[model samples]
Target: MAGGVAAAVLGAIGGAGAYAYAGEVPRGTSVLGVDIGGKNRSDAIAALHAGLAKQAGKLGNPVAVRLGDRAAEVTPADIDLGVDVEATVTVAIEASPNPIGRLLGSRTVEPVVTLDEGKLHDLLGTALGKDARAMKQPSITFSGTTPKPNYPQPGRGLDAARSADAVRSGWLGGGPVDVPIVEIHPATTKEDVDKLVAEFARPAVSAPVTVTTERGDVTVAPAAIAKSLRLVADKAGRIEPALDAKKLRAALSTPLGAVEVQPKDARVAIVSGKPRVTEGTEGRQVDVTALATDLLAVLPKSDERTVTGKLVAAKPATTAADVAKLGIKERVSTFTTKFTGGLGAPRSQNIVQIAKDVDGTLVKPGAVFSLNGHTGERGYRQGYRDAPVILDGKLVPGVGGGTSQFTTTLFNAAYYAGLEDVHHKPHSYYFDRYPAVIESTIFWPDLDMKFRNNTEYGVVIDTSWTDNSITVSMYSTKVWDSVSTEYSPRRNITSPKVIKLPKGPTCIATNGIPGFTQDAFRVFKKDGKVVEREKFTWTYSAEPRFTCG
Candidate 1:
């Protein structure tokens, strides 16, 4: 009994010692593979820090997550990957809570790893978001000259929540962890896309098409079809093929214009002292929509390779019947202006050319005729050459210089024809070649001799020129018995300024002329009775005569 008493006392003493020691972790206890056995709180936490540092090293190197050829890297340190050191120490303490239990079993305390998923998302976004587009299901494309199609792509997307969970779950475990990426499926599947492609896009681009009309033929080669066709997705997620009309029309515009006959307005002229009109002919035009439809239809089966669609006839803007309704019966009024036959032969040739240009123009009632418009741009193109023209009160060599002779002649004819003068500019200086105040001068673009045909009948102008002379006559039904011009004597005359020229053969000698202001009355008489009388006034500037030094 005494021995048993002694053994019980010894056991009690040993139990107290063990209880004091068991406050610390038991042997073989580790935090993420780092042994923390027999360590104090501070020492165990330091050991956990070392273990986390090792894990960080393993995760720092790039492990790329790839989709097709695209890849993004995940860095553990960038994501704030770390261990919960305090919590890990608490777990170690809990493992050894009871002295008896601590001595009985081995324990391993796993350190909780921490990370910022927002950081991960940011890093990945920059790396991966560049080429991530919503899938265009069953997209049609061209491979060389042939039409090629692709199946619907189940696109890839980043799932931050799932990725964060995975990274957390796998942190303790060692090895490479693949990033979790969500697959974004298209609205249509591969089978549906394939069927639609086969039905529309594939067949449309499979063969060449030819368009034919009575006028000509146009071939739409396979290469053109690839550029012209498009595939679009509908609300129901169906892929449908359609021709890009804008692109197709642009492609065919040049070819269509080449084969088509452009429309022309009817031309009017006086024949045999009466108004004569030439009938306008209809021209061929391609129907764009019809051609597209026919080509789409015949491309699949027709062996002729020839799409048959007749060209539509287009009507002209003016026809022969339109011109005949104008009442251009007889001479309305007539006048002839005479010029000296041997002065400025160059000017005479220009007068003849201008006459021919204005001859066929028909002036409708109340319509104004532009001398510059009828004469067009004058140069070598219209067969005009350099001649004498008055510029800054001096004669200078210029193109279309002699056209003023025709202008005066035409103006007088229209003047007696009872036409209203809309615009006219007289010469700056008085010259024997043109009548003062009543004559008109012409330049291109800015200045013109315009007159409105006020009478109900259309007027046909007739002009002809001889060597060193020009005469313009108006031919129309007689609106007045007679028309005559009365002129005022030259007044306000200024002495001509003399200009000395440098030694040159190109210099021209001119006679000094005085500038004057004059007035004229154009009187229209019907059966010996006074009718309309219009007064015209002019102010001329003195011109300096040039003398070669």
Candidate 2:
């Protein structure tokens, strides 16, 4: 009985000792490189904050996150990736539960981290904006004569949740945190593109398709089909076929001309040196869009491809009312430039041809007229003959040489009509025949003269030519009562250089002209008062004298 009593007392004493030891922290305990052994809960927390202050400060700043080769910085406060000091100490205290184990061994506790997924996600989006790549879907475009396909490509984006967790665990280490990147796949795969090409794009251009309209049947060739057909990806990246109705109409215009009643646009025709408006007429037009849709339905078929189209009444693009609204009734300005070439001369013929092409052109209000845009290449095919043209400071026989004479006349007419000059370049050498510092030259598409009709009324251009001169007149509502020019005295005059060349078909003799700088001021008058004055300046290069041996 005495031994039993002694055993009970010893057990009670041991239990009391365990209760005292558990009140304080375990010995040899460390948390985030901070030692807090044999201390209470409050003391352990204090030690953790004091010991981790420097490391926590480093983490509080910006932490660099690397996404492949691209890197961005993230502030701990911005993303909510940080440690909970009180919670960390509690975890360290609970790490060693057994009384004997806590007394005998050392424990290293991980810092408790706090991370808000919403904040982290937004922060990552801003930080890694450039590094994030978007996926591209497959598509086929009809930009060229044939269809060209753009293949699908994969993209990359950050794995936000995983990266945030990584930062929470690894940020305390004070180095660049590696972000996880995931591949983003496009909805339209490469296999889908291959299928589209084989199923539609390739077969659509394999043969010609005939479309029958109310007028007659028009055949669409394979090249035309290739130009009109387009394989595009929709919003969901699904490949679909489409047709360009405008291009299809252009291809079938010639064949359908015989069967269709075409509408005539309103135009101005010069009569007795006066403006006459010709009324437009409406006609039955083919429904090209519906016709193209029917053609697209049978483009993939190899045999018996034909469809019927409907005809509808269509109005002219420009009506008689449109022309009447322009208020073009009387002549506003006229200019004439005389040439030395007589009748049947190549230069005279060129001047007449260009004048005919530009005759009766109606320039709308606020519209710009381009000489080169109207008359493209003036090669032999365009009926321009070989004429003596100025080249390399000498006279050489070139096609469309004297067309510049027409351009100069048009420029002067536009100038006197109070039209705005968009672009014009004077001749390389001074020519007594042309008004000094006011004339312009043309060299195919490069050297062009352009003018804009800036008035509220449309301008009608009329051209008339004689054997030795060409005249251009503009008919519109006159803005100014009269327009005159004031010239500046010629300055910086230089003598011409005499050039000697062997006698051949290519060389022509010429008396060289002197170079000089001059300026002209356009005076616009309204009610006998000068309303506005615009200045124009130019420098002319001396034409070298070419002597034939």
Candidate 3:
């Protein structure tokens, strides 16, 4: 009975012990759980600290966590827990039956863990926030002293602060920091301002002053004086001062003497000595002499007081009376008879008188006198010859036929005198009596022979007639050189032809006369050498004859 009671007691004790051991397990603690195994608050805190420490080490810096009003700092040193927390099952035995064969039950209890999460977060936040604060309010200092003559002193202080802010912002974990910039005024010391003034200022330049004697003026530039003084000016100052009267006087005064200033429009007049006369023709001579005196009074003279004059006379006029007295007498006397069987015999004195009157009118040198001007219109009542004269290619009696002889003679005289023949003509056909290329025939105004006095001296023509002959002579100033004419041989001649005509009278007419051409040349010679040779071609047309019945 007692053994049964003892067994019951032992079984009840064993059941109670089992129930107590099962109740000892942690409510929220687990081997692999939410917080990674911690039974108490302290252990959990310790584990969190260890985890954060490891994380801080891997991050290489403090970890910062912002709280409501403050930041928490976590660092490797604050959170590093070197202790290991491990659970083990230990059984406390009161008694054992066999030392080697004892069966014992065990119970597990978690080991104590320690963490410093608050300290770790506080340290990290402090360190990192301090760095951020330092970056926000950066400090800058200048070691060098301020320069003298600080024209822009305030700018230097601001520039130094800006440089420091730039460096601070460039660092990692650093941001734009608000820095208080203060200006430090260095002690002012005097420096030779001349060099600085010279550096910044402009030097003066001077313009040259000109004094002109001809224009009678003097000019001075204030800039020139400023240049001489080596003056310099600032941006707002004048480059140079204006020229005062005193300065002007000082500049002008010299050993040479002050420059004279004349009126702006000053002028001077100068006069010369008596006039001079020059050689000229009568009227021209008088006018030239007058001009000389007038010009002399107006011209400027340097020295002499005397002036000279000259006079020249024009050529004299030669009249018929003068030519008649030239002592040239007619050596040959000749007569040309114009007789027709039917025409009544006119008094021969009528033609003779016409020639005589014409001879009274003398032609002077270089004179071109027209026959019409000297001879009135020819009429029978006027004592002109009614004798047969060629009119419009028919036989008509008029005052002139033989008058042409007078012109021919005068032409020859002019030619011999070495005058320039201006106009002349030849007969329609060749005439046997006249020299080839030397003959000159005339018919009043139609065929006129005119010559110019090419020689510098004057000439006179003399004419006279007798009952049987007429003669003409030319008198001129003695020529230093002799003149002569030469003729070229005839050329381009055509044979003449004979023809019979049926007019009232039976007379044989030549159909064609031989054509012959020649050139006449006048050779002007001085001192036996030919100076000039003038040529004139005389073309002869074929002469035709008519046989009349």
Best by TM-score: 2
Q: In order, what lDDT does every prediction score? A: 0.72, 0.84, 0.42
| Candidate achieving the largest lDDT | 2
User: Candidate 3 lDDT (Cα, whole model)?
Assistant: 0.42
Task: Please provide, for model 2 over 1-549, each residue's C-alpha lDDT reduced to its tens digit, 9 standing for 90 to 100.
Answer: 999999999998797557536646777778767888778999888888788786766657888888677787888788677778898878876765576666567777777899887787777767668778766877986554466779888777756668778788777776788878888666788887877777777778877777677667777788887777767776456776888899877877776676678888798988887788999888887788887788778877778777787888888888878999999998999999898859689999999999989988889999999999998889899999999887776789999989988999999999999999999999998888889988999998789999999999989999998889999999999999999899999999989898889989998998888899999999999999999999999999887877999
Per-residue lDDT over 289-331 for candidate 1, one digit per residue giving the tens place of the 0 to 100 score:
6676666665555365567755788788767676567665666
Worst 10 residues of 2 by lDDT: 15-24
Q: Which order, best to worst by TM-score?
A: 2, 1, 3
For every candidate structure, what is the RMSD over all alpha carbons to the true structure, in angstroms? 21.8, 10.9, 48.7
What's the candidate order when arranged by decreasing lDDT?
Answer: 2, 1, 3
Model 3, stretches more than 4 Å misplaced?
A: 1-354, 386-398, 466-468, 497-513
Worst ten-residue run, lDDT, model 1? 63-72
Error of 1 at 60 (Å): 83
Local error of candidate 2 at residue 481 (angstroms): 2.2
**Candidates 1 and 2 compared by TM-score, better number:** 2
